[model samples]
Target: MTLQANAGQLLVHRVASEVAKDCFALATTFRGPGAYARGDQLVRAALSICSNIAEACGRGTIPEFRQFLRYARGSAHELRAQVRIAREYDPARALHCRTLESRTTLVIKLLTRLHDRPPPDR
Candidate 1:
């Protein structure tokens, strides 16, 4: 892969990883009454974003890569929604939720840009 592609891939991976970590941390803050289910959904959505991005990088064709980027973007949106819910569910963690939401937005923007741009030769 070209250096530029490699750099872009690394950036996405790093940001996705951060989102996953944040989600996992946020999930732990849930307490009492449907906490487990809500936390699990948040974690799953966050992991999906990372997984989709990784899958996109491994795909042989640009089309496949773009498709996966779309999936990742969708997952990021899902995570954003979850973050909002969590913020409302636990006002004590509002700051963390806002931070996570911002990061998720960043991931969405990054994935969208990657999906729209012409792919480097694979």
Candidate 2:
């Protein structure tokens, strides 16, 4: 693999890692009834983003990689939706949720770009 491709992959991985960490931190803030279920779903969505990216990198074909990237983007969107719901459910934590939502948006944009780009020469 070329240095450029490696660097791009690393960047995506780093961003996804940060998202996961932030999601975990956010999940810990959940409280009251139904909190556990909501937090678990949020955490799962966040982890899915990272896992899909990793799976994409592992795939042999560019099409497979792009497909996985799409999956990752979908997870990011799901996480963003959960963040929005959390914001409404816990107004006290709205600011934190907003921040996480922004991060998820960034991840979505990054994944979309990666998916839309032309396949690198084999």
Candidate 3:
């Protein structure tokens, strides 16, 4: 509820939004059947990362929030793997995938810092 925590949330939300946009762009850009399968997986993992972060931020306890952040981080890792496979199927998407990987790395760092913050009551 403090201004500081609110600012942190806004930052995370913005970063997450960026990641989601990248996912959508990459999914819609890459086309063949093989690319389709990998893209689908990538999109889902990307979406999960945002959803999990939202859930964590809204939770009632720090432990609950940390747990969800962990889930979100895991999703980021999953997306990394999926993007690698997607690149194999559609080499043209390599640049986008690399961009996504960089974004995901940033998200992971944000999540770690967010997780380490003191409980809201403190």
Candidate 4:
């Protein structure tokens, strides 16, 4: 392992970076008209997915990271729900949100696996 490198950190860092960048794109592309207020919900939830993972990975112990991963997972699920809302309430943004939601789900899957794996002993 290289300096400042570990399985958890590597996974969390990459996932977080992706989430951040993706959310930025989503925000930029968001349309103004919305009756369901899905735009704000999606932006927040998508951002949370990465931030929580990064925060959890930097925690003091594995159990703590697990707690954070749980948060990240919840955020991922919320992001999916928010995106789906676009389909029902804001049809125009639905596809774009779907793409972001799908990516968020993949990140969630990866994080869940990382959370389940045994932590390396330092």
Candidate 5:
């Protein structure tokens, strides 16, 4: 089956796809299988960003998509934060975290621009 690309939905899809790829890389690096398991949490948060965006867009409502974009942005931020936490635990992973952080920041910018509207005339 082929994925039909929708112009209105491109940004979210692109950002989400990139995020998913990075998350997969992150998951492989994560060694949090023991107590206080954070691996799953990180993966969930990362995936949630993309899933929420897709779900909202699928609903076919601008407002709904905006709201979901808010959550998606938050998820990106959460993943970035989690990456930092992991970096703290393992300094060597700083490079990986930095890369993910950069991509996540771009996602936030695109979402913010898409959702933010100009002020109405008085």
Candidate 6:
């Protein structure tokens, strides 16, 4: 498949993508069946941030987009908490959590900016 520049140009997209990648890496660190559920939750939350942003953009309305951005931001916050819990459960993954936290922060800040601003003219 081909990649496009338009979507990549958004700061939210870039940051969210990074967070998702980090989360995927962290998920693989999960050991045993008991830890699988927790890892799955972290993966879902990370992916939700990326999916919500894209879904928001697809809604074709500024208000809808802003609303979705808020959803994405909420997901980011959730991921942050999940990361902290993961760190507590497994200290070895603390570094991964730190990186994910930083990327998630960037996504939240960009989403806040998009939500507050008027839609750009087509």
Model 4 scores a TM of: 0.73
TM-score of every prediction relative to native: 0.91, 0.89, 0.84, 0.73, 0.79, 0.87
Q: In order, how many clashes per candidate?
A: 0, 0, 0, 0, 0, 0
Give the C-alpha miss distance for residue 66 in model 2, angstroms: 0.7
State how far residue 19 of model 4 sits from its true place (Å): 3.2
The TM-score that candidate 3 achieves is 0.84
In candidate 5, where is summed lDDT lowest over 10 consecutive residues? 1-10
Best by lDDT: 1
Identify the runs in model 3 with alpha carbons over 4 angstroms from their true place. 1-8
Question: Tens-digit lDDT track for model 2 on 15-55?
Answer: 87898898898889999999889989999999999888887
Error of 4 at 24 (Å): 3.1
Residues 7-73, candidate 3, lDDT per residue (tens digit)?
Answer: 2355765797788888888888777666677667878998898888777766766777789889988
Cα displacement (angstroms), candidate 5, residue 5, comes to 9.4
Cα error of candidate 6 at position 19, Å: 0.9
Q: List the residue pairs that clash in candidate 1.
A: none
Model 3 per-residue lDDT at 54:
77
Model 1: how far is 34 from its true place, Å? 0.6
Error of 6 at 63 (Å): 0.6
Write one digit per residue (lDDT tens) for candidate 4, span 1-122: 21122434566557656766766666565565763254567677777877777677577577777787789889888877766666566577677767777777787788788778736646
Q: Give the Å error, residue 13, model 6.
A: 0.8
Give candidate 6's error at residue 120 in angstroms: 1.2
* Candidate 6 error regions (>4 Å): 1-6
Q: Between candidates 1 and 3, which one is better according to TM-score?
A: 1
Q: What 10-residue stretch in candidate 6 is worst by lDDT?
A: 1-10
State model 1's lDDT: 0.84
